[model samples]
Target: MPTTALQDQLERGVAALGLALPAGAVQRLLDYRALLERWNAAYNLTAVRDPAEQVTRHLLDSLAILPYVQGDTLADLGTGPGLPGIPLAIAAPGRQVLLVDSNGKKVRFLREAIRALKLEGVQAVQSRVEDVPGQFDCITARAFASLADMLAWGGRLLAPRGVWLAMKGQAPDEELPGVPAGFAVRAVHALAVPGLAARRHLVVLGRDTA
Candidate 1:
């Protein structure tokens, strides 16, 4: 599909999801998609090549969790080319987002996207999830690692009462047993990303108050 048509699809999909995105949010996401396509040609930022597929997989897939995401600060661990982080930041310009990835090339692409998008409260940091500093009220991990490893490496970075939104392709029941201490699965939400048929689930974990 042409870029304009793909963007039109995106606008409709966003509305279908009932997301009241701030002004220019959809356009910025479209801009980010264009940047990803351009950079992927040279830097190989992402495996998804088609712009229309990206609109469904990358843009809508990320936005599907917008309703669950809350708080003022968020961290996107292993955010290669800023999957959900960049889009989330674009949607909620008020929240601060840290896009953390160790790869140099991917981080470079993220930095370029951040600058080109002119996203205010978003930064791409090249650091391992375990080594990144500061605590966030909400943390997002998309196919980064298993539940245990993700929390083991970055659990300390989550605020005392923070929520961890882990995006998974399917129900990760096997990984549930290994959730580290001090955390528990609060909810498992099945995400319905527009135009994509694959099973998508968001595992919501919260600090165990007990």
Candidate 2:
């Protein structure tokens, strides 16, 4: 597909999501996609190969949860190649984003992406989610792990009143029962990503205040 077509697809998808991004965000998004594509050929960072699919599955799919993302700091646990982290950072330049993954190659790609894209306020760390220190106002885990395990590992990183956004393929009804204690399911939002027909859901979890 042509570069223009990819840009058009991304633009349409962004519009469909009802998000008004900051100036130059669109171009940055495209640049990020291009970088991912280039690195993917040799590194196999992501299974999604086609550029068009990258726009739909990677970029737009990540932005679908933008409306619900809150707080000034976000930690993307197990962010392989910075799926939602990089895209979210590009979309919201002001927010501080931390991309965490244990894979050496992926972390290297993330650093390069951050430097190449000049994404200020974004940092990539190579550490297990459970070992990552500090708290974030918002946390995102995309198909990284089950609700039970994710919370069990990285639950401590969520700040008081912070929100955890777990991206899954379907409503995780079975997984709900396994959610660790001290965390409650705030809501489950069905995401409608443009140019893709797969069921996407965002499970919002928060620390139990009661």
Candidate 3:
């Protein structure tokens, strides 16, 4: 994806989305895309490449949940390449973002993207998913796991009233019979991530005994 053309399209898309980013923010995403492509040559960072998909799928797809979040702090689990976390931070600059991933290389790329984007209040930590103890105002993940498994593994890290935003491809069909008690599924909403194939949706879960 060429810089000029991508910039033009990004300008329109960002405006349409009613967001005003810094001068070079779109460039940073493009740079990140380039880096991903380069790293994929050896590191195999991500299988998604095409520029539009990078913006719509990788970037906006993660951002689709921005409207649903209502806090200043967030943590992303298994944030392979900073999916919703990075994009979330970009959309909400005041947020304190904690991105966690066990893979050192992926964390390195995340750190690089953070630096390139000049995104404040962002931290990329290299650690296992279950090891992050402190709670966050909100927690987000893409392709993490089934609702039950994710709650089983990462539920404790959520603030007493915090919400878990999981980006999924399919609408959660069957009720999670084994999903531990006290946690409730709040809402299921469809996410229209342009330039991607799979249907996207968001699952909002929190500590509710209903």
| Superposition TM-score, candidate 1 onto the true structure | 0.98
Better of 1 and 3 by lDDT: 1
- Pairs clashing in candidate 3? none
lDDT by residue (tens digit), candidate 2, 1-210:
998998889889999999999998999999998998899989999999988999999999999999989999999999999989999998988988999999999999999999999999999999998799999999999999999999999999999989999999988999999998899999999889998899999999999999
TM-score of 3: 0.89
1-210 per-residue lDDT for model 1 (tens digits) = 776898789998998888999988888999899889888899988889988899999999999999989899999999998989999999888889999999999998988888888988889999988799999999999999999999999999989889999999989999999999999999998988988899999999989999
True-vs-predicted CA distance for residue 186, candidate 1, Å: 0.3
- By TM-score, the better pick of 1 and 3 is 1
Return the TM-score for each candidate structure. Answer: 0.98, 0.99, 0.89
10 residues in a row with least lDDT, candidate 1:
1-10
lDDT of 3 by residue, 112-159 (tens): 888877878999999987888789989998988888888888889889
Overall lDDT per candidate, in order of appearance:
0.92, 0.94, 0.79
Consecutive 10-residue window with the lowest summed lDDT within model 2: 3-12
Evaluated with TM-score, which candidate comes out highest?
2
Instruction: Give residue 61's lDDT in candidate 1 (0 to 100).
Output: 94
Q: Which scores better on lDDT, 2 or 3? A: 2
